[model samples]
Structure formats: C-alpha cells, structure tokens
Target chain A: MVKPMTKTKFLERLGAELGIPPATLREEAPLNSFKAWDSMGHMSVLAMIDAELGCEVPPGALQKCKTVGDLVALVGSKLES
Target chain B: MITQIASHLPRTVLANEGLAQLYPDWTAEKIFEKTGIRERHVVDEGECASDLAFAAAERLFAGRAREADYLLFCTQTPDYLLPTTACVLQHRLGLPTTCAALDFNLGCSGYIYGLSLANSLLQSGAANRVVLLTADTYSRLIHPQDKSTRTIFGDAGTATLLSKESGSRLHSFVLGSDGSGAEQLMVKTNGARFPRADGLPTTTDESGNVHDPACLYMNGPEIFNFTLKAVPKLVREVLEKAKLSLDQIDLVVFHQANAFMLEHLRRKLGIAPEKFVLHLEHCGNTVSSTIPLALEGVITTGRLKPGMKVLLAGFGVGYSWGGCILEW
Candidate 1:
C-alpha cells in the first residue's frame, strides 16, 4: 500500500520537483515567483503530482492555478482516494 | 533481424549554452540536469528530413542499396505533401525498380512500427530485404523562441536494415495509440485539415513558452501522464505476449524523450540502471531516430550483442506507443 500523501508531503514534493530549497518555499508562494516553474518545470510539477499522488492534473486545470496553495488544492481534488 | 543501423545528425548544432544565452534563467548544467540534453542538431536552411535520411541510408547501404526489395520511410516531416518521401528515397538510393516503397507518418513509435511492417512483408514473402528509415526534422516544426521545445528536440535521421534470418528473429510487437490525446503534442497548422494562414497567431503561456499556431505545441504534463499510464502497461503486455519476464530482457531502450521522464519510468518500472540505455545526452530527442540511435550506441559499446534479448519501446507524438522484444 502507498503512503497517504498529505498536503505537506505534496508541497514538499512539488518544491523538490521545481528545484526549490525545502525551507525556502512558503505554502502561499506565487507559482510564478519561482524561476524553475517554467514550462519544463510546469511539466515536472504535474509529473511529480502523478508520481507522488497518482493523480493526473489536467493541463487546463494546472493553467488555472495561481499560488502553490492552489496547486495543492487542484492535486488534492484529483486524488484517487 | 536488423542487419545494420546507421544514424545522421544535421550540420548545425544547438547546445544548452546556446539556449541559456537566449533564456538567461537556465544554465547549461541546470538544463542538462532536467533534460539530460547537452546539444541537439538542427537542419540548415536548404536541408530537410529526406536529406538526412538519404545520408544515413547511404552510410547504411555502403553500395548495397540495390539489394533492397522494399523500402519504408517513417517520418512526420516528409519533404513533400504529395509524392511520398520513400519513393524518392528508393530512386535516389538506386534501389531496384521492383522494390515496394512508401512513407508512413509516425514519430517516436516509428522504428517499432517500421520493424513490424518489415516483419509482415518478409513473413508474407512480399520482400526479401526491407530498408527501414526513420527520420524527422522537428526543428522545422518548432517555434524559434519556444524554450520548452527548443531545449528538448533536435533533428536527426536513422537508417535500419532488416532482413529475415533463421537464427535471430524480430519478435512480436505490442503497438498502441490514443487520438483523443493528439492535441496534447501537435502542430496545429500546415495540413489539409488546417491550411497555413498569413500572420501566424502566437500566444504566450504562463511558462513563457510561445505557442505559434504554425509550430509544434506540446502539453508536456499531459504527455507525461499518458506515458506514466501507457508504458508500464505496454511493457507488461509485450512481456506476456513474449512469455518472458523483465530479467530475461538483456537490454531495454525506450524513446529518449527526456531525462527526467526516462529516469522516472526507469525507477517506476523497476528497470535496473545498467540494463537500461540512454543516448539523449548529445542528440536530445531525435523523435523516431532515438531508439535506433540508442541501439546503435549500445551495439558499438557491446552492450547489445548477438543472441541477446533486447526490448525496445517507443512512445510519444500521435500519443502513439509500442513495445517489442528482439533477439539481436
């Protein structure tokens, strides 16, 4: 069985995928503030979400996210459980 | 069996440093870490996919081009929308007039599909030897400043010669596609469905990558998700069809899409690092040429040898995917 992915784990994984230092990222951080959140980084985030949580975030849905918190919400909504 | 495999890259080279100069935020090391692409070759002004294909085929043939009884050219970027590129290649290569030749539009999954066709033609006694050429100059289809694509794709063509043999065989293949996800990675214009319009419209996405209606557009996350779902299943189905397990496959080579994705799949599928092959560091994603190029690399390095069971999987573009086991 897979570990239940918590919001904290989700953000940490997302930050790791984007190459963000662990303690440097705040939950309310704007998604656009990070230089690594470019197109490739965007793809990495979604892949990370799917790999870490097994939830495929629709590309359009990702486009709607403004803050890292919004991304967490989008991912949480798509969780299989 | 694939008797020989040859690959060709265009003259112009685009290194990550070149890309970093354009997109300052990305350093060469940073780009390499993410994509595992150091440099990619692109075609020059007068060059095209066919030219590269011709060159690679010439090298593959080495004056034996006339022995081919059939020719198959796999590409998405054909020279002309009218006469098929394979026909022109046949004549240019001096293949016999009786040879059956045609072009099939496929991307990363092309080499597998080409091998499948060659297998059919040989098994049916339709042809004695098949010239399978997979080439694509995706650089022609990409927007100039689209860092996402420019950093990932490079142009290349590869020629693989296949012939029926008693000892070695091209085993069964598991091929797949999903058109519903076609828009995820595609070029929207320059086709019968949507002819080119003047003043190509462009849009800038949140990632700052430009989307030109006339150039390539890849929804990276969507394709990644598709791969995450499709590839493992494809691997399982192919293994079942062959009645073999992962340990039995001597080597595994998948399309060199990107380093991150390939590394992820390698781990997710429980594929051992030493058994897997990655040739993307220099060539980047050469579309259809990737698998063959990787094969050629391993062959030269002695990683692939006669009697070894090699598993090849190609997935992407057309949302197409395929897997097959070959006795090398």
Candidate 2:
C-alpha cells in the first residue's frame, strides 16, 4: 500500500530539509521573497525530494520553481511517475 | 572557577605546501616569522573528520582514568550530515548508547562551550564523565592558493576528557557570540547547497578555483576589530565568573591565531608576556584545537604545576569568543 503525498507533508518535509523553522514557510509563501529560499535552500529542496521521492527533480526544474504552489505541482507530477 | 581539561593532538604535521607555490617569492621562514607559525598537521587526503577524531579519542580513553558517560563533540567539519560525530564516536569508544551524545558545530570557542555544557551536565547530575572533542581539517576547506587564509590555518584535532572535580577539575567559563558579523570569517561555500547544489562550477576567486575546494574567507580588519573589542572584555568576565583576579591566575592559553594578535591581547589584558604558553612558533593556528594542543605541548616542559590557576580563551571565525579559568 502506497501512501499519497499531500501538500502538508511536502511542505513539512521542505521546511525540515532546508533547516527552516516550520512556521516560517507558508502555503502562499513566495519562495524568493524570503532569504531562506536562496541557492542553498533550493538545492536542499532538490536533494530532499530526490531522497524521499526516489527520483531527480530534473535540470532547470528548480529555477522554474517560484512559489510553494509551483513546488507542489512539480512534486505532484514526480509522484505520478 | 573553570573546569579541568585533558587533551590529545595529532602526531603528524602538515606544512602549508600551497603557500610556497602560490607566492613563489615568499619563504616558509618568512611566513613563520610573520604569523608565529612553523608548520601545521593535515590529515592525509581521503581521510574524513571521524578518522582524525578517533585518533584523539583513543588517547583520551587510553588510560581509562574514569568512566565518561557523556560525549560532546565540537567541530565544523563533521563526517556525516545525518549521524552527528558524537554518536559515531560514542559507538566507536564503546560508551553506552543511553548516555547523551551531542554535536556542537562550533570552531574557535569550542572548548569553552564544551566545558560550559559539561559543567551544566555535571551540575545537574546528568553525567559525571564527559568526553569533548574539537577537530578541524581547515586544510580540507581552505583554497590551496588563497594566501590570506592558507597561511593562518592548519589542520589538527584535540580530545578532552572532562570529569567531576575529584581532586582536580574545571572551574568556570565566560562565552559570547555576535551573529551580525558572522560572515567576516567563514568557509563561504560547500555548505547547505551553496556550491554543491547544482554541480555547475561555482564562481570563485582565481586562486580558489585552482583547487576546487571551498575557501575560507576573511575580512581581516573587521575580524581584527571584532576580536580587539571582544577578547579583553570576555577574559575579564570569565575571570570574574571564576571569582579570581588577574594576578591570581598563573598561565593564559589563548587562541594562537598569530603573534601580533596574541601580543596585543597580552598587552591589553596586562598579563606578563611570560604568562602565555607559546606554541604558535611550532604549530600554526589549529583552529578549535589550539588551546588544548598548547596545553599538551606546554605541560610537558612549561612547568604547569598542579593546583596553579590557568586561563584558556578562544576567538575567531564565528565572531565568537570564550574564556575560562582552570586549576591544574
């Protein structure tokens, strides 16, 4: 039985992966608006998702990512694969 | 009233091989004269932080003096991101897993923080024996060609066995941090995905790119300003915390960054030049291991008689400084 990944778990994982305090991240949060989502932060997201999702997020996929909603969509498609 | 300390240092020495090649005109002797450094030990290539850490740990536990129940490892270069070096060390040392093991990712003020943590743990009856290790392979992070940092840092590690004050132990410590000026001294890459994020070649200074390793950067004047302002105050505070006056202390083991800074600090603190244990002439700044290594090298020949008061202080990198007094 496979458990479905939800926005709540994904965001929680994202927060932990980036070493950010949970409350600092929001569903409506624009990633670039915060200093925490810089190059390192983005890489941490990519690594964390790869480890948990069992696949690479694809080149340039991260640069395309701007908001939490964008990240969710990207992650959701990877889940389908 | 700083706590007692026991320490172990690496047996090998690694001279700054990169400096000579980068600055062809400068000689090692000249570098030594300027920085108060002769040579520093670097772990062989492919060696991880734990390997160097284990060497020190083995010496610390070799005598089996007293049962150590707590393990605290202070290092900036850890072996793994997931399992803290404390746990791995605990497993390797065969200490009971139930005992608390923690990793403090601190560099210069590591020993002070380690002592403070041990004191708190002991005062609370959490544990009587604690093992604190400080190790840094700055050479691993340093750009081979960046003369600014290359000449100043060296690779080395130290392990201290802290126990309850049976006949002798630690006294007290004073510590401080300023986050605003953290960037003044740091390894600006290879952390939290900065350079490692994409595997695309990251932009680097001409000298730094030659080796492809993350280079330690410093704003020399800013760090100097930070140290000049903080070190003396912190020393006074630690002495006060220990309830001792400057005259009552015997020896001072400061972070051996360089001769100029140490001399300036000695002058500022009004401590007689003889009160300082001089090891920088032989071993460059060993980062976190400086104070402990100095203690080991000095105790053998420097006449650190029992029950004499000594002060240990460390400053740099983190824009952090810490000091403590211990009765040998």
Candidate 3:
C-alpha cells in the first residue's frame, strides 16, 4: 500500500526536487510562473515525488494548482481520497 | 542530403567532482552494478549548462554559425533561474538576435525532441540552419547521498547541426509521454510550501521523511517495467513510421543509459547486439548526449557509412520516450 503525502511534505518535496528555494514557492502559486518551476522542471518535481515519496499527483493536478497553497490542497485532497 | 553534419563537445570540463568525492571507493563498474552508469562528466564548479552548450554549439556551428538561423537547447540543467539558456547561447554564439531561440527542459529524451523540433522548423521553412544542443549537469540536481540517481547519472553536453537539405533529414519520429509513471524517477524538495508547511526538511534519509534533496530516488523495478513495456513498442512504431524494418537500420543508437539496461532492451527487442555501439564503458550514461556520442563513435569508427539509415531513441526520467530514423 502507498502512503499519503502530506500537503506540507508534498510542497517541500516538490521544491527540493525542482531545486527551487522555499522562499519562491508559495501556496496557491502557479508553478510554471515561478523561476524554477517550468514544464520539464515541474515534471522532474512530480516524478521525484511520486517515486521517492510514493505519492502520485494525478494528471491535471498541476493545472488545478494555481498557487503553492492550491497545489498543496490538491495534494492533500488526493491523499485523502 | 543529411551528410556528415557538424557536432561537438566542450574541452574544459567539470567531471562530476561532487559524486567522485562522495564515493571515494565507488568505481564505474560497482556503481553501474545497481544503476546503469559507468562514468560521467561534470561541469566545472562555476560553469553552467550554457557554457557547455555554447562550447559544443560553437564547435558544431564553426564555419557554419553564420548559416544557422535558429538554436534549440534541450537540457534539464540551465544556467539561470530566469532567462532560457538558449537565448544566452544564441547571443554568446553571435547568432542573430532575431533568431528563434528557446530552452527545453528534458532528460534522456531531449536529443530526439531537439531533433524533432529542428526538423519541424526546417520543414516549415522556419529556419535553414538549426543548432540543437543537449546537455545536463546532473551534478547540479543530484544529491550526494541519494544512491538511486547519483549512480545512474553523469553530466554531459552535446550539440548537432540540423540543416535544410534536399533528400534525407529526419525521416520519422515517435514520441510519447505518460504522466502516471512520472514519479518513478525524481528529485524532491525545495519547491513550494503548503500553508501549514515549514520549509524543506534537511533531514537525512534515515529520518523517515518523504522529501529529501540530498539524493535522486527512483523505483528501479518500476522504471524497468515501463522501459521494457514502452521502448520496444516505440522503436517498432518509429521503424514502421519510417517505412523501414529493423534489419534495414545500419545502426541503433539507443540512449547510453547503462550496459545492463541496454543489454536487456536489446534482448527484448531481439536486436543483434553487434548492430549497436557500446561507449558507455567510458562516457558513462550521458543522458541526452548518449545518441550523439554513439553516432560520433560509429562515425569515427567508420561503421556508419554515408546513406546508411540510423535509428536513434532516448528514454528515461520523465517517463518520456522518443525515437527517430535518419539517413546519413
């Protein structure tokens, strides 16, 4: 069975994996709009989280994530479901 | 015709010093035992992707720079947090500022994507001479302690010149992306924060924390399953798209990921082992450069003759896979 990734953990993990500093990545923040989080960078982030954290963010979850906050909420929702 | 197009690599190198320092006793053989890497290069401490990109592009476009009108750089590692490295490279290479320049963040499949993009531009008359550069300084993203990715990756950069030709250029390309398996290979931590979340945890893997930047993690078995399942299918598709059969290809330049994976892939594809070149022994798993390096090797060795058809493919990291057939 796979464990759920907490909202906080997910963001932290996403940040670390993508090499974006925590100062820039905020909740409800659009990932691609950020300096570090581009399309491929986002993919790398998601790939790392799914593999290392054992949590999978579904397709389009990225679109739902308007802010870093929104991203975490989405992750949390996914975890709960 | 797609004759001997230009390509080149950088001279002053970084050479994976961090990874080397981390594992004093680890050699390419032992590291590759688990992951599929024999060795890799690293950028010099201060050097970024653009340096290598510019170097390779300069060499590949030398005496031909003024001829190119577009530059495409595919890499997971770039110099800045903002401007695309392609723009910097274009300026540095003295390319026309009006030229089309962009950076693509991709891993193993990068080279093929670059080629595909260049082909489209050329076919559309968007450009006459296209410089495609693929480079990754895995040293930049890899965590020293994370055994999963550290072993499999090595920093490398390669460049290829795509020109508008009459007969043969990029024959056909097949590309696919599956988001479901995206997590099988990743580097996590240091991105954004949920409202309640603190900054990234600096804990070691021993702490049982999920996100750690100190390493690259991958479900080896899962990736293996994905590769075995998708690669052969894609290769066949690309071959079919090219209107050629496997037996017709003079050389197969699959990504130089590892000896073991390549061995397994070849066996699964039923490809004669001899049709491909094995340069991973020294160059390690150079991700994007794998195919070009292989092409360079076969060309330098005189194994690939003019007019020979070549099948090139790259897959890894993003669950990304792509391949193309080209006539030399």
Model 1: per-residue lDDT, tens digit, B1-328?
A: 6888898999899999989999887899988988999999999998989999999999998856458888999999998997998999989988888988899999989989999889888889988888999889899888877888889999999998888763568876999998888898999888987787566678998767889989999988778877888999999999999999999989999999999999989987889999989999999999999999999999888888788998899999988998899898
TM-score per prediction, in order, is 0.93, 0.73, 0.71
Q: Write the per-residue lDDT of candidate 2 for residues B76-158, one digit (tens) a residue.
A: 88987778888988888778867688888888788778878887788788887777778878777776655656677777767
DockQ, cand. 3: 0.02
Residue-wise C-alpha lDDT for candidate 1, range A1-81, written one tens digit per residue: 135677767767887888787677777899898877776777778667666666756546786788887887787765434
Tell me how far the alpha carbon of residue A48 in candidate 1 is from the true structure, in angstroms, after superposition.
2.7
Best lDDT goes to which candidate? 1
* Model 1 alpha-carbon miss at residue B6, Å: 1.3
In angstroms, the error of model 2 at B109 is 0.6
Winner on lDDT (1 vs 3): 1
Q: TM-score order of candidates, best first?
A: 1, 2, 3
Output the better candidate (1/2) by lDDT: 1
Docking quality (DockQ) of candidate 2: 0.01
